[model samples]
Target: MTPKIVIFDWDGTLIDSVDHIADSLHLAATELGFPALERDAYKDIIGLGIIEALQTLYPGLAMDEIQAIREGYGRYFFSKQTTPQNVFAGISELLAELAGANAQLAVATGKSRRGLARALESSGLGAHFAVTRCADETRSKPDPAMLMEIVEHFGIEPGEAVMIGDTIYDMDMAQRIGMPAIGVEWGVHPRARLEEFAPAAVASDMAALRQALYLA
Candidate 1:
């Protein structure tokens, strides 16, 4: 059966913002005199919330220092560019097609509320999602709370909704909630890692993702 509601992850899934995220983290670590995260380790944390990211990387930092790091990362990310950057090709078309097909699109992201809002506004994607839940607002990805909230808000059962994202966090969360998920190549985690979560499809590209979601 076709899904009535579709949940999407931001950052590497829909936009090519992994560089920005890694860069910002490096900047924050340098500014705070903490060790910078390695590229692979950094990529692994892409779908996690900022606080959680910091905690995992620097597990013993003081609370104030963690907050400072968070602030510093935000400064680096937004200051370097005039606006959000690096949306993947065909993303707008995919969302538009999904919308045209009467899909109720929602966003379940690891981005904080402020970060999600900034990206949505800068990317001009706010109108596409009928509802959004961020990690800051609920449990982070892999926990299923965010997905359940979106489904509950829309009054749809888990079976009627599907998640389209590019990370294990997204896939695991959907699985825990008994929702089907479609994985895409345009994300931080490797395709093999994403496949370990058993998504409905590990789409090789945006066009394939569109076909899987709209045609399959």
Candidate 2:
């Protein structure tokens, strides 16, 4: 069946911003007098929002400290690194193919609404997505609320849309809503880690992701 709409995960799926994220997290942690997260540890927190990520990283910290760290991370991430985020190779081509196929597009991300908007505008992908649901619009990843919001906003059913992302949160949220998910391997999370969510299919690269989306 043809997909009526396509929902994308912003950060690691379409944009290669893991390095920026790690940098911000590291800077924030250091500023807060906490240990910087190791690379592997950062990978494990890819899909969650900043608040959740901070909680996971410094669970022993007091609530106020956690809030402060989250605030610091947000400020640095948006002001310092967002503009430098580059789109993954072939992602633009794939998105073009999907758009040419008349598939409505949207974004569901753990990023804040303002941050996602800035990233898209800076990256020249703002016009491509008809709707964008960020952390401020709904609960964080794995909640299914954002995905559900996207579906409703676009007037499409779960089965009529596919959620494409690079993390388990994306896959599991799609599963919860009975939507097919196309998992990409080159993002923050590795293939082995993504497989735990039982995605409908896994794509090793943008070319393969196009095929999974029935655009190739």
User: What are the per-residue Cα lDDT tens digits for candidate 1 across 1-216?
Assistant: 347998999888888888778888888888778886688777778888888888888888888998999889888888854243466878888888888888899999999898888888888778899999999999887889999999999998998999988888999988887899999887787789888888888899876887788654
Residue 147 error for model 1, in Å?
Answer: 0.4
Worst 10 residues of 1 by lDDT: 80-89
Cα lDDT over the full model 1: 0.85
Per-residue accuracy of model 2 over 104-159 as CA lDDT, tens digit each? 88999988787887888888888889988887668888899998888888777898
**Model 2 reaches what TM-score against the true structure?**
0.93
Error of 2 at 85 (Å): 7.1
Q: Model 2: which ten-residue window has the lowest total lDDT?
A: 76-85
Candidate with maximal TM-score: 1
